[model samples]
Target: MNAPPRIAAPTHAPEAPRLRPDRAEAGALTRLALPIIMARIGLTLMLVADNMIVGHFGAGPLAAFALGLMLVQTSQMLGLGLLMGSAVEMAAAFGRDALDEVGRIWRRALAYALAIGFAGAALSQAAPTIFLALGQEAALAASAGEIAALFGWSLPPVLVYVASIGLLEATGRPYVGVALLIAANLVNLGLGLLLGHGGLGLPALGAFGVTLATLIARITLAGGALAYILLLMPGRQALGRPRWSDHRWADGRRQRRIGYAEGLSLGIESGAFASMTLFAGWAGALQLAAYTISINLNMLMFMVAVGIGGAAAVRVSQARGRGDPAAMARSAATALLLYTGVMLVVGIAFLALPGVFAGFYTGEADLLAVTTPVVAGIGFLSLIDGAQRVVANILRGYGDTWLPTASHLFAYVAVMVPAGYLLALGLALGAGGLILAIALASVLATGLLLARLVQLKNRRS
Candidate 1:
């Protein structure tokens, strides 16, 4: 005998969605989007706080933190990008009343997360050598290596959080994930202040202290998210556990099929950004620290766009499964408009308060004097960068993955990397040159991805 359909709890009780998708185009998207946007911002803010704290420790500590992040974030993004398949797949399944498949997809995602996280941990050992080869100061690179190793150990928890959050979002439970992230941020803030400042009679851990905060927060997120998942899905809790009998290799392979394109896209984009970190290192430790601050501030705003994009992805996938082209277009359009509006406001803040934000990262007059302009540049760059990021995500929601991956390669590898290298080194353009290149890449990537979205919209219609 076959098992029963495994539909989990809907936003309401366990009932079919009344089949009313008319308003889901805009209203529903916004509803799903708010909590997700807040969650993304929350996570980014926590990291920004860490940067602010470490920046005050001194330029050297900030530089070490930047160098360490160069490796950890790139790898983490790659793994998380790959796991986005879980969201897309589960959303489709949930829409089509194949909720049991959502559980299968979740399990596969967890498996991939653990495997990828451990691999990244092992690979992080090479960060020091990579930084040195990229022309970083030997001392800064060595210190960064230690921090990177600690960050590597923290990835398993981070990946678990990613997996759990994706599952929750896919199942129309983003609020739970948001709540978990908020709780984790509170834990992180307390620990960050405590361990970071050596408040309890311990010596200051400097950059290492920031990393400790990250580890503790990540553990809190994973543990909390898992408990939530179990509470919401009591019957399938056994299947959610990682067991040979519960999950199959075939399911893992199926998920990876969709994920590889996203992974490539993220790797291309992140690799280009990481190279900018190297370019800053070439300038000196001070420049690297300043660059990190500017990038961190820019990314915090970018998270708003990412959250909107992720929400759009879920809505689009569901609309597609339900065979509703109009709803899909509406979701995409609404996401673009909302993300643009928020990012524009963020750009204005960056323009108006560049020095204020720079001061948040550091109070040092010397660092602030030089960092202000860089932070201002980030404000300018945030416009196109945020646009491209969300547009790419929107396309992914339409199940157009490979094109986005190819576009990123062209934008990052072909456009940004070469221009950044030539303008920064050959012409001595410094950080300005690199950011200008980033702007170009964002433009290229946005154009390509938007073209794909247009084509998809037309085809679907």
Candidate 2:
């Protein structure tokens, strides 16, 4: 021992710990987010294309399409929120290694989405008279009615598409969902060109043709996603075989609870937006048309932020399932930071060239005059909205949905709508006042949501 002491004394230092992030989690978030972002971009492009063609045709067509979309989106928001909430639930189950439970949840969610979609479609088709009752101009009401009729036929397929995409994303195969959306969009674009403008010797069907193309694309994408889940990726640990028996009320009670809360929350928020548009309509047709154009562009940017927030939900839910609150908090923070950065860039770009962006949708001088202030308002509001969305997703990931529902009800219903009407109609600030109210409400909501997220995170800690 003494002879070997000199050699024995030599000790190697401990190896430095490698700083590999949780690769699976990181990869999962990136894979899920990128596809959603790309798909949203494609959707935005379609919107731009629609606006371009419709604007070139005339103000009436543009206004009709915009109003129709506003109504359709208000209905669709609830459905989409339900699907998204269900996806988070399934993803959490997958993280807990409960594969069968994920399938059970998915089946129930899909059933709900289908039923809701069909019912919505029927209502839109059967109740064109309802638009007349909303105090809209006679001409505007009739135009909206026609657009709603076309939307009715498209709702089921769109619902199916949304449900399938939720399932796929929950099962850690979001890329497949993205691919299907891309393919569908490509087909839609080609068909839209053929039917919308009568290219390729096809009949020009105008706005109705655009809706038809969307319906076909939705059906194709939904069918393809269903096939992939049943045949190609059936054996994944995250998605077991679909079980009809698991599609029971008892099995989906928790999911329904969360999904309904999420849906109602989003509906309240969207309804606030609808109210703003109504106020703009009261100002005049030109104001409505202009605000619609600017708001559509605003939503396109907002969707990018939303897609990122959705990815945060998946990542945070997975971490929570693994009992790692720290990782969950960090993931959410990262998502918020990323969203803020992106929104800053977008805000600056919009601020610098509001007219340029507005030009893509309309060339009407009167419309542009109203839209400029509205667009400027959005430039500031986007930052608040983008940040709040991320925080809201974090709360959702942790299964604290009811709080947000209450927050939206209070913020939007109790504050935003009344204030907007007073400012726009009562105070005669016109479209500018309407937009200002939106900005104010958004700021309030963002603050509330951020505070709630902090509290939730601290409690978990």
Candidate 3:
């Protein structure tokens, strides 16, 4: 990967625009964040639909689906993160008005996606063994393994298209993905209802049915995104054209350098969450129930941060390419301010109406009692956690990768996991202990990334 060029600031600081709050800047930030946020929400809904469909079958099937999907998603996260580097690269390239270079990045990303996707497929086939090793019930493991193997095979299309989605986003047509993912969700729901419950004289496929439905939906979205790029987007043919003289082989390593760090960062961060989920099991059934519901909501809200962060990424990449230090500063500041302000509102709502959110998930008084504090506390967690996600993306936009990745590993795997065990198990705080660990990790990560952003700003001048 190339070293990012520093933003050369004028000797006179007063000549540049001040980085402060303004209505026009805030409006621009909202517009940029909204579509990306919509895309994230759509993707979240797709998973929610799968979970909902499987849930109708019974607790056992739901457990299998949950375990199986997590296994698949673990690998997906790695591959997806690796491919994500292309988006940042392409966005910067676009900022420089080098359309052909953007195309080359996308082509290489698709190739990487295929290679990684196949490996994921192989892992899916062995997920049952993993489940057994993790001490899951034999029957549950078997069911989950079957579903994972089949759905896992779809990774090639799923990931290849994800790279495509990134390219489209970098090219400034971000809404296309939003439309396709939402449509895909609808397709998944219809097929899930049919395949899982059985219809038209077909037998019920149970968990496998939902997996199959998800696969088909993925294919449709992937196909749709590709078609839009090739047929409708401007300068489509310039994309994917190889330079015969240049060694395409060597660039793959550069792409890996670019993306692998982000992927590893995500894996470690997610691993911390996974470890807590496991810890919850040790806490007991009631605590586990509370942990799962509250955590899921946390994740959902985190997506909002992701959306805001994604917008920052696009803006920052473009700023880098155009060599606009002031623009870069404004983009980052506006995104941070916007995200924090919105999250504070969400946090306040959670504080005031924690029971209201929990009631939507379950009616059991015990479950509600356990969930309320977690929900209330989540408002603050969301503020930091969401900020951490954005800060990571912002750094990625500046072509800074591994440092942030290391920060996540240190904060999450190093800090959060051990803290959860000590606090939850050692202190007997149960689910509350795990939540506190998450909050600590998020706060640490957010602080470090923000400091890095500041350094980058100072360097620009």
| Model 1 residue 412 distance off true place after TM-score fit, in angstroms | 0.9
lDDT of 3 at 80: 73
lDDT string, candidate 2, 220-268, tens digits: 8778877887778867545666677878778777777777877898888
Worst 10 residues of 3 by lDDT: 13-22
CA shift of 365, model 3, Å? 6.5
Relative to the true structure, how large is the alpha-carbon lDDT of every model? 0.80, 0.74, 0.80
Top-TM-score candidate index? 1
- RMSD in Å for candidate 1, one decimal? 8.8
Residue pairs in candidate 1 whose N, alpha carbon or C atoms collide under 3 angstroms: none
Residue-level lDDT for 20 in candidate 2: 26
Residues 1-461 of candidate 1 have per-residue lDDT tens digits of 99999997667543222212244366776777788788778767778888988999988899898889889889988997898777667776776766667777887778788999999988887888877887788899899998898888778888888888877776667778788888888888888878888877887777788789888898888988888787765455433445565367766665777888888888888988998888878877887887788788778877777777777887777778788777778777887777776777777888888899899889988889878887787866887888887888778777777787888899999889889888777787666677778888898889888888878887775
Candidate 1 weakest ten by summed lDDT: 13-22
Question: Estimated TM-score per prediction?
Answer: 0.89, 0.87, 0.85
Question: Model 1 off-target regions past 4 Å?
Answer: 1-25, 96-100, 231-243, 322-326, 459-461
- TM-score for candidate 1, please give it: 0.89
- What TM-score does model 3 achieve against the real structure? 0.85
Clashes of 3: 0
Q: Model 2 misses residue 27 by how many Å?
A: 9.1
